[model samples]
Target: MRCLYLWVIIALFLMTTCPSAHADEAVATQSFWAGLSTKAKFQGEVVSNLVGGLASGSVGNALFIGGFSWDSERAGEWHGGKVVINFLAVDTGNPEAYVGDIQGVSNLTTVDSLMRLYRLYYRQRWGQVTERLGLLNANDYFDNAGVACDLLNASFGIVPVLSQNLQGMPTYPFSSLGSMVALGGGDTTLQAGVFGADAVHPWQQPFSQGVLMML
Candidate 1:
């Protein structure tokens, strides 16, 4: 994870240190944007013994996300094309291990404590229709409600009844190789996708485990 962080920092440094060009030239050719964010949480078990055993404890952890986006129109390559690269880094410890909550106390909490590529996708749009290929997160397009945007519980972010039962839903913490297409514009639009069933390391096996399609 440290190595991954170093790489991201170095890349950002290089981008920022590049020779300065006219603002119009930068916008007419290509544009790059980078961002880094971290969320830390501490959860303690006050009362338990009903679900994950009679043990009570507390755990603290953090989630780090850093990435960059490149736009074709902004980069002056083409129109309606963009590329995104994102990475996820989880600190040691799982909050659910202490809270023993099925819904999860923190939405950012995950079992894995490592750094990995989270999203790497390219999108192209033609009028009202758009196509995206490569790694993806299903929740970003489906079952997403503005009302629950700030919720911390895992179930609130994505309905557990569906996300939990699905073998590879491709929500958070885990992503899969997939392709998505959408038609229409304005307030009404239609989207459909086919994603790999393997939650972890889907790129290695592709859709060997099967596929999950969403509409």
Candidate 2:
């Protein structure tokens, strides 16, 4: 466990520092605009059962996220083209076990401790119209309310109607293969996509697993 933390820190340091290692001015100017981001958060909670819930216990956990984005136009390639990659790693521990509910007290909790590719997608835009494809989190495009982000409750992040009922409503920890298109910009935009129902194994039963369509 400590080794995992060490490696993740080292990897993040290398990613941020190595990109500018090239001293050649010409090479630097020609290279695409690559942006890197990393986040490390540690959270602890105490649950007191004054009534009939779960047991009164406490748990502590950590979450690490890293991401990179490249702009093609900056590299002298075609305009309106970009690529994004994201990775997520969570320390083992279920905060919900102390709360006795599945909705979850911590948004970072997953079925199991996991470190996987969270999102890898390509986006292209032509005027007000934009398109994206590959492993995606549906929450990024739909039901995304900026005002509710600061809340810690899992249900506050997304509506239960979709998260609980929608078979494969792509949310955190389980992005699935999908494609989306959007028109318009600013205050109003029309967007839609078809995503694989089985987010855990998107490749299995690709067609029969059902699909999630949002508009």
- Give the runs in model 2 whose Cα sits over 4 Å from its true position: 1-29, 33-52
| Model 2 score (lDDT) | 0.75
1-215 per-residue lDDT for model 2 (tens digits)? 99999999999998887766754554656574432333444444433345556666666656676777777876767889888888878775666666788666766666778888888899999999999998999888888877765436677777778887865667877788999999999988999898887777766675467888888
TM per candidate comes to 0.71, 0.75
lDDT of each: 0.74, 0.75
lDDT of 1 by residue, 1-215 (tens): 99999999999887776644455556544343322223333332222233364356556556677777777776546689888888887774565665656777666666667788888899999999999998998888888875775534556688886677875768777889999999998899999999998868776787888898889
TM-score computed on alpha carbons, candidate 2: 0.75
Tell me the spans in candidate 1 whose CA falls farther than 4 Å from its real position.
1-57
Model 1: clashing residue pairs?
29-75, 29-76, 30-75
